[model samples]
Target: LVALPHANAQTDPLPSWNEGAAKKSITDFVARVTTQGGTDFVPVPERIATFDNDGTLWTEQPFYFQLAFAFDRVKATAPRHPEWKTTQPFKALLDNDMKGLAAAGEKGLLQIVAVTHAGMTTEEFARTVLDWTSTARHPRFHRPYTELVYQPMLELLTYLRANGFKTFVVSGGGVEFMRPWMEKVYGIPPEQVVGSSGVVKFQIGASGKPELMKLPKIEFVDDGSGKPVGINRFIGRRPIFAFGNSDGDLQMLQWTAAGEGARFAGLVHHTDAEREYAYDRSSKFGKLDKAWDEAVKRGWLVVDMKQDWKTVFPFEK
Candidate 1:
């Protein structure tokens, strides 16, 4: 490893990361995982790090990526289910019904994604994500979904690479869905991203087009305790460092913490509602209950959005 920052002085890494507590956390964790005598230290190349994307890296105020998938899904499916126009949750999402969306609850949102994502090919699903993000913007932020990512977290990703850690996004999000834009938004290349994925097969249509289809079946979901499962599947090693926000990430943090020797786990508590959506322990989306308790008990770092971060988003207010 070279002495130069942002790279091992050997493998050049994300250079755009800024200096901050977030950055420190990242560096300190990487040091623990890679140093020779470090308790959490493993080797250089084997230093695998995992992160949950939605609430952990960005905002999930509205919901997860699948929720956004559902929104577009409902619109596409509405033509078939005409009655959805008058239905409760469908009706809300259809007519730009923010109020109805609020009323739909978790079950309503899942209903929307199930119908939209299950049967499509992986390629078609990717296309849908690209197309939807092109037009969709956050309602309150009024910014493109890609633009809603947290700047500090982005910087943290870069900073980790400066050390010896190989950062991987082990998110609950649809793998194909996030692959397209995450590179541009987070500076994390597509290959480094590990998220939930439906089965995909390469197929050439009779029309002579390359189409990757999303199977009507779910192959895997990279959420909850599944985070560690995904890490094992994709990166093939237990990570030394893990970052997450909600209870859904409990298993991920637990798995990371349970590792032998030096281990670091951090949670980004959404405490700044004025700047971003702030709800924990009781929020409908991205709730932080069990993880919050565990974070305290285990002496894991719990970041209060209002206290730790000097800034949130990239854009200046």
Candidate 2:
């Protein structure tokens, strides 16, 4: 009788990834770092991996998913705050005028975020995020936003974790926004999820119980240069691996690559317009221009969504 391949040997750690350079790079790096006595071997304590949330892990076309939630929150609370009807950015959003909203600019967008994401108890905010993620559907896919996460990415996260890597999401999105459902969705607990955050204050509720109330004031903006700062402040260790998908993540990637020893830095290049959105330099959200150039220059592994991923979303058959 002919010998067959072992059952474990036939199992693919990243089934959603196509057999190509991107997949090979990931597997090879993991193998090198995990192998005992190897020069590239990294200790379990130092096996930290950082990932970006928006375009790197999920779809971020048209706008960010957090921004979509903010817009929905504005609509839901509009009746109570009728003043929003006459307000510039809020009015533009209510009127569904993309041009007017764009004209309002970054400051206006921050205003929206401030209103929608704050002025509530931390528990209440988390509950609100959980509810929204459960019910809210993406406009294009008609599936829940959480379900829009890339299948290959999910596999990669799991594979990394299985190999003694501690993965953390260091994203530009709000920390509270991601922490609510990160454990359920990504197997990463809230504590491991770090992102941009607003200020909060301790207060006593009507029931005399203490609560942390979310404030409109920004505390930390964990994007671009802020990423390395946040990582240093919160994680307290230089990550051995980092993966991201925009100019916002350039600094984080740089920080990871700058660390001594064998490090892995990668980017997800959105190149599939057929299955997903295709964008790079000119996209309003998650622009991959500077980071793309940097990845090319530094010889970082850039996973082409069109060519490297066998599947885009988890819902895809």
Q: Could you say which candidate leads in TM-score? A: 2
Q: Write down the lDDT of every candidate, Cα atoms only.
A: 0.78, 0.94
> Which candidate should be chosen as best, given lDDT against the real structure?
2
lDDT per residue (tens digit) for residues 47-88 in model 1: 677888988788888666557767876887688899987887
Per-residue lDDT tens digits for candidate 2, residues 141-199, read: 89899998999999999999999999999999999999989898899998999999999
Q: What is the lDDT for 274 in model 2?
A: 92
Question: Mind sharing the TM-score for model 1?
Answer: 0.83
Query: In candidate 1, which residue ranges exceed 4 Å CA deviation?
Result: 1-26, 34-41, 76-89, 96-107, 118-120, 201-204, 208-210
Give the Cα error of residue 114 in candidate 2, in Å.
1.1
RMSD of each: 4.9, 1.8
Q: Show model 2 residue runs off by greater than 4 Å.
A: 1-10
Check candidate 2 and list the clashing pairs: none
Error of 2 at 217 (Å): 0.6
Count clashing residue pairs per candidate: 11, 0
TM agreement with the true structure for every prediction:
0.83, 0.96
